[model samples]
Target: MSRAIRSAPSAAAPTFAALALAAGAVVAVLLGVYGSVHQPTGRTLTTLGFSSLISMKVWLAVVAGMLALAQAATAAWMYGLVGGSKSAPRFVGPLHRATGALAVLVTLPVAFSCLWSLGFQSYDTRVVVHSVVGCLLYGALVTKVLVLHGRPTPGWLLPAAGGAVLTALVLVVMTSAVWYLGTQGVPTSTGY
Candidate 1:
């Protein structure tokens, strides 16, 4: 007679991590709500050497959105999700992280200015899309960070979160910054 070998039971579920993710998501959504309802202060924070703060914001948004695209591309290459080499170089991972961090840094001032000076105004179609994307962008970023730090989430989770962040950032740039630059003209408005 032969006896079957049994594997040990797995450790307890990561309840704390799950809870943290939930809390982060909630906080992000609440922030979006607050931004939406809050009235915009007419005054804007200026960037040194830039014609106006809005111009700086536009330039930063473009750079951040481009970096986000690069992140997505590198991630795809790493995962072999695109038509390219079956594996990405080891440097790709570090590059992705560095680009993402830089993108976040670049966007911080732009986000602060948008929320502080414009709230979530929607006086036109572009503005409406921009407002909605802005809300989603913060939420997506929070979710992406949570998943990045969370314990062993599903394989699809990280890519999905990253994709969402990229999409939202692109939409925000297209609808607001790019549109403003193309139609209304750059540095559309000046100091308070």
Candidate 2:
């Protein structure tokens, strides 16, 4: 009888996943370290039509958070985790990507303002939590991107990375924008 041959299992997927995770962890650590070491300028770029940098940042963050929610819904639809359809429509993927991109775009200025003006602060519980989560946000984003684009990875990896990103986003928004809006209320006049 002729011998039957079997293919060896490939380790590429696990290896890539590990590398991606390590890269993300490194980025997160570096950001925290840099923020901790760097001196904050106490000044940030101003946006026209906004009362203050803080107001602008808060509003931008809110917008980003909303976009992230949309991204989540679209992602769920694509995975058949939401809606009643067995298969996602062709538009779902594009919509998910667009919303994700928009969310990142909206948060860029806010992140820059926070990192440049405040650095990493730990004077209070809320501030510390916000700072920590802010660093985690970028890390999670990196990991999610890698997992999404990398070679065939375990089915669970993408969702885990996405969940991490979403969690970080929510925490960052709740700690910063929500807190600010609750305590300061909406800015009504310029220079507020």
Candidate 3:
């Protein structure tokens, strides 16, 4: 009988995941620093026939939140957390990708507008919370993407990163869009 030997698992995967997470943290910190130091342009954007820039941002954030919710659902389905099946349906993967892409697309304009016009305001508690979490949202997103693309990562890493992204996104939406809707109500008219 021959003796069997098993090699130790490679350490590179965890190291890569750590490095990616660190890079994401750096990106987030840089964004926050830039937002803090740079003077706001106070310039507002008009788009999609919104009555005001704030209204536009509010709506866009709402859209992004909805898309994020869809992303979460699809992710759960893919992982078989929601569905009873051992394997996800093929459509779930595409739907997840599509919703994730759409969420990013819908969020970009709002993020640009915020950084350009607001520049990480800190006058009020809500503003401060919103500004900080806004930066974290991007950071979490970066980490999630990096972990996803970097193969051989720890099985738990991707889900952890994704959960962080989702949490940050929910906070951002709650602090901004939900607050706006509560105080100002929905915009009835569009610029178009």
Q: List the residue pairs that clash in candidate 1.
A: none
Q: Judged by TM-score relative to the true structure, which candidate is superior, 1 or 3?
A: 3
Please identify model 3 stretches exceeding 4 Å from their true place: 1-9, 45-49, 188-192
Please give the distance, in angstroms, between residue 184's alpha carbon in candidate 1 and its true position after superposition. 2.2
How big is the positional error of residue 116 in model 3, measured in Å on the Cα after superposition? 0.7
Better lDDT candidate (1, 2): 2
For residues 1-192, write the lDDT of model 2, one tens digit per residue: 000011222479788888889888988888899888889988757664577887788888899889889978887787677878757788887888898988888888888788878899999999999999999999989988887776666677777888898889989999988998899888555442
Query: Candidate 1 residues 1-192, lDDT tens each?
Result: 000011211242245346545765786677678778888886766674567887788888888878988988877777767656666677887898899999889888887888888887768887877877777777788877876765555455566778888998899889867887798676644743
The window of 10 residues in a row where model 2 has the poorest summed lDDT is: 1-10
Cα error, residue 178 of model 2, in Å, equals 0.7
lDDT of 1 at 44: 67
Report the lDDT tens digits of candidate 3 across residue range 1-192: 000011222579778888879988987898899899989988776555677777788899999999989988988877767868757777887888899989888888888888888798999999998999989889988988887766467777777888888888889999999997898788655421
> When superposed on Cα atoms, how far off is each prediction in RMSD?
6.8, 6.3, 5.8
Compared with the true structure, model 3 gives a TM-score of: 0.89
**Model 3: how far residue 41 lies from native, Å:** 1.2
Clash count for candidate 2 is 0
Worst 10 residues of 1 by lDDT: 1-10
TM-score of every model versus the real structure: 0.83, 0.90, 0.89
